[model samples]
Target: MQVIPLKYGTIFKRAFGQPDVFCQFTKDILGIEINIDKVHTEYEYPEPIGFVRSKYDLFAEDTEKRIIVEIQQVKEDDFFDRFLYYHLISMVEQVGGYQAYGFDRTVYTIVVLTSTPRDGSINFSCAVSDMNPIDEYGRTFVVYPHRLVFLCPRQVNDKTPPLVKKWLNFIEDSLDGEMDEVDYPDTFWKKIMAAIQKQTINPALLSEIKDDAAWEEAKIRFVAEGVEKGLGKGREEGRAMLLKQQRETVLQAREMGLDEMAIAKLTGLTAQELKKITK
Candidate 1:
């Protein structure tokens, strides 16, 4: 479509994880009046592999608490690993210079994730939510009084919940050069279009971007030369060497009474090919 979401958040994070994207969200998205007193990226806590060290997409400070925004594309089962790490990082402010090593400070972690669960089928494939949250003031809610929420696709409709309504639309759908009618702020829309235009409007960037999109498209082309190259590269010599090795393995497996499906899975050879070998 016309515009893509301002992701490359990972890319942007790589460039400016300390203060740019991290601070933008708190000030812009949350409409919070907080001055960024300090900011750090790749925060490390001296401990083991899973201990207080994490490279955040963006991490920063405000007047009251530390705001950590993690930009992720794919969702994994152990996603809470992100929250757990951020929880640890929040301890940094209180334990200034490691003196107060175990003090509890507030942290706001918002994970921007992939598409949402459509039709409210409870798609928790890549999400962890408090099966319950306390209403702060009807405008805000917190899960376990620590984290906020994950923004995904299905949360973008006119009637969807407010937390992700802006974010979901920015990523899934494109803007029609008209931002007023939409839900997200105009400045946020500008950031979105800036990301998309970087990948589309320029001649060279367009070639690269469209090539990325087109490569995913499947098309068939018959070519004798490709087949010839496949066959002619050490044709008989390599073939004899590997064929014997492969055939011997297949034969041994067959002798063990394994079925055709099992042999196919092991060798990546077609059932028909395995049958020919056996015969």
Candidate 2:
């Protein structure tokens, strides 16, 4: 059946928004059993705590822990830093009133990268990060419950876990073209796939997919033109032209409702640089 790629923001949100699919996914990927009634998409902190805010792709919480799942189709230079901030912010938000700064619930962040990661050490299909402290005497402290997991579908191999591999394979296959129903025989997989079937997608989502495609094409064209213009000009001129293009792209992305952090990721601009450009 023709399946819409889950790499797209709208499609990803739609499929995983269902509680069962989300629970099944987290169970397989994180090996955690969680029962959740609602999944929040594009979730933001109700009150902005500081200058920066976080908007998560998928967020769910039970009594003991909060789960965040982010799907990043575009590779960001500060991918690790960005997600770390998101993880911490979720923990920090728990503190209220004059109470002690004790965290009531642990936070778990799962980042799924559809593209190959730029970091060499992240060659494996799955990597986990946590706050397990170790002493010089080979002693370990397992105090912190918070954890971060990175999943790169493109890096799947023989060593990858079978269930995790199947999930990743589904994501990778959908991006390529039509996905055979026979390949996803599991009831859970079939349910997830049905959520993103081409026939079920409404006209509004179809338009969004088209707009995303156009934006990607425009970025490619812009980069190509910038490179050609740079080759035809002096070093200083080329730098100036590139900077101009970057500023224009930032403004366009903002108009399209992309956050500053997202724009920085796509343009390789720093927060300060983005502020200056937008100002």
| Highest lDDT model number | 2
Q: Poorest 10 consecutive residues of model 2 by lDDT?
A: 114-123
Candidate 1: global Cα-lDDT?
0.54
Give each model a TM-score: 0.48, 0.78
Per-residue lDDT over 1-279 for candidate 2, one digit per residue giving the tens place of the 0 to 100 score: 998887777888899889998898999988889978999999998998557978999999999979999988654478888888898899889887675888899899999888764557568888889988999998979999799998888889999999899888888888864889988788878888888899988999889987876886787689779878877787778788888898899989989999978998999989998888667
> Model 2's lDDT to the true fold?
0.86
Candidate 1 lDDT, 113-207, residue by residue in tens? 54332345445322434324446665444433344546555345455545445455655554232233245547645554554543445676556
Q: Pairs clashing in candidate 2?
A: none
Scored against the true structure, residue 11 in model 2 reaches a CA lDDT of 87
